[model samples]
Target: MLLQTAPAPGAWERLLAVLKEWDFAVFLKINTVWTGAFGDFLMPILRDQRTWYPLYAFLFIYVIYKFRWKALPFIIIAGLTVVLTDQVSSTFFKNYFGRVRPCNEEALRGMARLLLDRCPSSGSFTSSHAVNHFGLATFIYITLKPYFGKWGLLFFFWAAFICYAQVYVGVHYPGDVSCGAVLGVLLGGFTAWIFKKYFNFGNRKRGDLTTASPTV
Candidate 1:
């Protein structure tokens, strides 16, 4: 007789099972409630690093004043890279994949009770918030690493917080956040590198190049 193996669970079924597990359920409930109560409120605030961009711009301007006019072009290039990469990832990849939000699926409907409210019927799989925030964080951290030294780790935490907030709010899956983070890091780093090589932007000491830290 031929040996038979058990079939693998479908993606949706696996997601449901993961959601049903005790630890994950607890996290899901806590995150759902916390994010639900404030998810929308916080989303507008944290969605883009745009709010923080002005502050960074001011800082970079100050750096230019302290350093040299050459820094202006670098700052402008870094800022534009962050903005463009973030917009492309959020607008194109997130929508193109067009995965359904976790709470919107019938397979996971029972887990909905743990959610603060129904998940939005928008595209999922990759979180815009995660992509934008992480992308910005990665770009900024890489740009400033030469100056901040170990302080760069803080940006990783900042990105992680933003990405986790997505899952907590029931808008994305762990997998979605994970993939978004990876994409964000790659895009952010690539953008930064391109500007550094072509435009000679930011602090581009040859040794300063580094990979983006993981989030989620």
Candidate 2:
């Protein structure tokens, strides 16, 4: 029998390995040290999309009620924003990186606490939840800011909250969510700019939604 020795990693590869270790350390800190009974119960709920069905419905209804026919294009663009973010993050980034979820890692079987019933088989470089939510948040903030003022900022906090819950629930690393957020923001902002440029929804002064608005 012949024994073969593998080549050692180069500096760049070694650096990436070190970064990965640091990411795992951060994941462990969030998953283990920052946990509690209340978090264990609430994070899963917060991170779950099912929990926000009512909010989604309300937003759909509210946009139509406020903007009438003009809401159609906004809705379409918003939906596309989420789809783009989800696909780019989940399909492209995940497949490219192929990083394992902490919960799904055999090495972390005893260490990582998985709050969900089953851990997904997808790769974990960029969190789809973070991408989707942050994309939507960015779209909402930019498109609706003229009407909602500073309240639009709340959308970002909402996105961050869900991303934090994702880490707390043990599915994604902090780096995954952080990069997802940046990508989401870029995509969402681009879509919003497109909508504003072509669709031309009434850009009333900040917080002034009472005036008769122009339709797209």
TM-score: which candidate is best?
2
Q: What is the TM-score of each candidate against the true structure?
A: 0.63, 0.91
Q: Native-vs-model 2 lDDT?
A: 0.89
Q: Compared to the true structure, candidate 2 yields what TM-score?
A: 0.91
What is the clash tally of candidate 1? 1
Superposed by TM-score, candidate 1 places the C-alpha of residue 96 at a distance from the truth, in angstroms, of: 3.2
Clashing pairs in 1: 35-39
lDDT of 1 by residue, 1-216 (tens): 988999989999988677546434554664555555466567545534465667566767755764465566667766676677667766787688776676675666666432334456667767766676677677767766666668877877877876765676566776677777888788888866765566543444555444222111
For candidate 1, give the lDDT of residue 142.
74
| Clashing residue pairs, backbone N/CA/C < 3 A, model 2 | none
Per-residue lDDT tens digits for candidate 2, residues 1-216, read 888889889999999899888988999999999989999999999998998889778888987888888889999999999899999998899999998999888878899988899899999989999889989999988988777779889889988999999999999999999999999999999999998888856768555657536556
